[model samples]
Target: MAQVLFLGGLGRSGTTLVERLLGEIPGVCALGEVVHLWQRDLRDDERCGCGERFSACEFWRQVGKTAFDGWDNVDVERVQALRDAVERTRHIPRLASAAKPAVDVLEYASYYARIYQAAAEVSGAKLVVDSSKHSALAHVLRAAGDIDLRVVHVVRDARGVAYSWTKRVARPESDGTDEMTRYSPGRSALLWNAHNAAFGLLARRGVPVRRIRYEEFLADPRAGLIRLADFAGITLQPTDLDFLRPGHADLGVGHSAAGNPMRFTVGRLPLRRDDAWVRSLPAAQRRLVGAVCGPMLRAYGYPLNPQETR
Candidate 1:
């Protein structure tokens, strides 16, 4: 079984940056958003974080061949249909309640198992980090019945998340035209609350999970990496992490199947906080986001009042 450190959370909560930091560790291989690999990598033939189109990327080409004999053998539509059927956020409740899932759900999970195991084998990694971000997918991975699954729930301020959703960021992995999806403040708030709550339930259900708040992680990312590495069962000496001493890291090359455009970034990346949302989110939307995410916001230790941005 593959030991997977699954990064689960609402989108736009800094999961990509965290994943990149973790990938720098020696024994961990980061597979960005394997949940989206079906549509984004295999179907659309998008660019990998390595800057190669999916078909041309030697890493994933090997992962496919190792898992399924070949990507050609994959039934993309069938997997996609199965995903829509049982892998949705709406299905989380029913999926979590049952020990056994329907035949189709099991079959959908089988693909995930193979790919993750194959990724482990192909990369010869001690741990595979999948930054899929959908808390619901963790349940599906659970159903796969053969993975050593662990979850790291990444939480960010709902207001910041809502504000990020309004930005018009381009998806570089695409044909250079399509942009990342943007959501209204209300919708983003609702999603933030729902996903965070779902991950909390995952912990109660006995899947080994550790929670990491994005703000605290960013405040001291070098320490953040050590804590994350410890949770994942890897130890790092101070020398192993010396690269981050300058308050930045020249990130190593990565081949995420899909994630924030930040996945494509490498070189001397500054470690700094992104509080743009704190300043730019309109007061009205801040209030609206606050109302929708009130319970979880306080639960996660965020101030109710979005104080004037510094």
Candidate 2:
């Protein structure tokens, strides 16, 4: 089994960036949102991170062939349905303790194992990063118990996440035909509570977990990347840190299956914290988010009023 660094968090909370950073490491391959692999990558034939459609991308085509004997042998619809049944928030509690799983759960987990193993073999990576951004799926993988998994629970301030979800950003991988889904502040806050709490529970149940706040990561990316790399069992060489020069990152292309539009962005990108929600989010909405997410917000060390927050 390949060592897996599973980035679990709410959507729009910078999992894509962290996953990309991890993928930049020499022996790490980033597979964007494996939870969406069946529907988004396999069925929809969306673009890969390297600018080729799924069917045409030699990397994923090889992954299919190696994992399932052939891509054509995979039943996309059946796998998608299995995902729905076994990977849901409601199933996490039971899954965490299920010594033996139902037949469907085992089957779903086997597919994931094969995919991760195939990805590692094809890319020649020691570890693979999966930024699936859901507690439920993390629970499923943890419960399945085959992969060597570690969770990096990325968290951002609820207000910023809510503000991000409100934006109508285009999904460039979808050929601009679709947009990222929007969520109201209330719904986003509820999700922030649910997702974070779920991961917290996962940790309490003995899963090795590291919590990274997005603000802290942006505060000093080099330090953050070093910390994460160490956690992922990779020792860094000086040249590995060369990509981080001054205040920017020199990013190269990858073959990620699905992620934010940033996945397609290569070359040097400026490094800065996006704190627009601090000044941009409406006061009432901020208050609403604070009220809904008060417990975890405090638990995660976010300021309630955010006087000088990033």
Which number leads on lDDT? 2
* lDDT tens readout by residue for model 1, 74-109: 999999999899888898898889877789889998
Instruction: State each model's CA lDDT, in order.
Output: 0.88, 0.88
Give lDDT tens digits, candidate 2, residues 1-310: 7789999999999999888877888999999888887888888888898999989999999999999997889998889889888889888888777777778888888888889999999999999999989898888777556689899999999999999999999989766788888999999999989999999988987889999999899889899999999998998888887888787888898888887888887998777889899888899999999999988898899889867574
Instruction: Please report, as a residue range, the 10-residue window in candidate 1 with the lowest summed lDDT.
Output: 301-310
TM-score of 1: 0.97
The alpha-carbon deviation from the true structure for residue 227 of candidate 1, after best TM-score superposition, in angstroms, is 1.4
Model 1: runs farther than 4 Å from truth?
308-310
Instruction: Give per-model TM-scores.
Output: 0.97, 0.97
User: Residue 12: error of model 2 in Å?
Assistant: 0.9
| Model 2 vs. true fold: TM | 0.97
